[model samples]
Target: MKHPVELLALKQTHEQCLAHADALGEALADMRVRALDAASYEHLDKDDRRLLDQFAYRYTRLQDDMGAKLMPAVLRALGEDIAAMPALDRFARLEQLGWLASADDWATLRQIRNAFAHDYPDSAQERFERLQAAASAASQLMDCLGLISRQMLQRFGDLH
Candidate 1:
């Protein structure tokens, strides 16, 4: 790749994104082991609380890095002018370029992330359901990152 230096930085961001996804995935796995309901959710053990916290933190970090840092870096590496592009514009451009599967999907994922971030469910049932939804969305987001990784490999033939 002509942009060896640029690809190197992209590679770093890509690895970091993967790490976040992996951690989130593990948390989701932990989530699945517990048959949590509203009541159960309210009385989680310390370990369960840690796992939930991990899930929330990793999910946000992964989305933020991918949208705010990695996506722009990817565009910049591909010679696109992304300095002024809104995040939605970046997603649309990536979709138009055949890199992203669908910008709409990305928007949905963002909504899920935002909902998980800001929502303080008044009902334990709502919190339980929200956690379930977030876990599914986290898995989908991880898949999206995997797709992006495959695309990167196809384009550059090995980032290292």
Candidate 2:
């Protein structure tokens, strides 16, 4: 905490992650308006299909980047000693500290993410279900990011 350089580095990294989350949240909002529910997948037009495909790609990337990169960096900026803990324990601690809603929610997000990653192109029903779920999860993930961002601002003031 005494080292200005170290603090500056963390602030910069944290800001970058916050910016990415903000961008992804905006994209998700746009996609949500155009996205179809699972019940309507069979009715999507050609244009809708194109839009949905783009949404699917962005959703998966946003989910992956947030979990793999952004969350850990944010945790570190918040003074979490993540390097010493296992991933599950780290998430559990974040939950305990109110950074995450629950460890189980984090686990569910991971499962949804994995489903997206292994999706079969030939299975329309499965793909539609996964996209619908991912779209829902994207909003929840944004809420989590918002909570983390608020806590960061309260703890560190303007991170910029």
Task: Please tell me which predicted candidate would have the highest TM-score against the true structure.
Answer: 1
Worst 10 residues of 1 by lDDT: 1-10
Model 1 over residues 1-160: C-alpha lDDT tens digits? 5477778888899989989988988888878886677788978899888889998999999999998878887887788887788889999999998778899999998898888889898887888888878888888888889888988989877876
Q: How displaced is residue 95 in candidate 1, in Å? A: 0.6
Evaluated at residue 149, the lDDT of candidate 1 is 91
Per-residue alpha-carbon lDDT of candidate 2 for residues 99-146, written as tens digits (9 for 90 to 100): 778888988987886787776656668778777777677777767777
List clash counts for every candidate, in order: 0, 0
Candidate 2 residue 44 Cα shift, in angstroms, is 6.4
lDDT of 2 at 82: 80
Q: Kindly give the stretch of ten consecutive residues in candidate 2 with the minimal lDDT sum.
A: 1-10
Clashing pairs in 2: none
Tell me the alpha-carbon RMSD of every candidate: 1.2, 3.1
lDDT of 1 at 71: 85
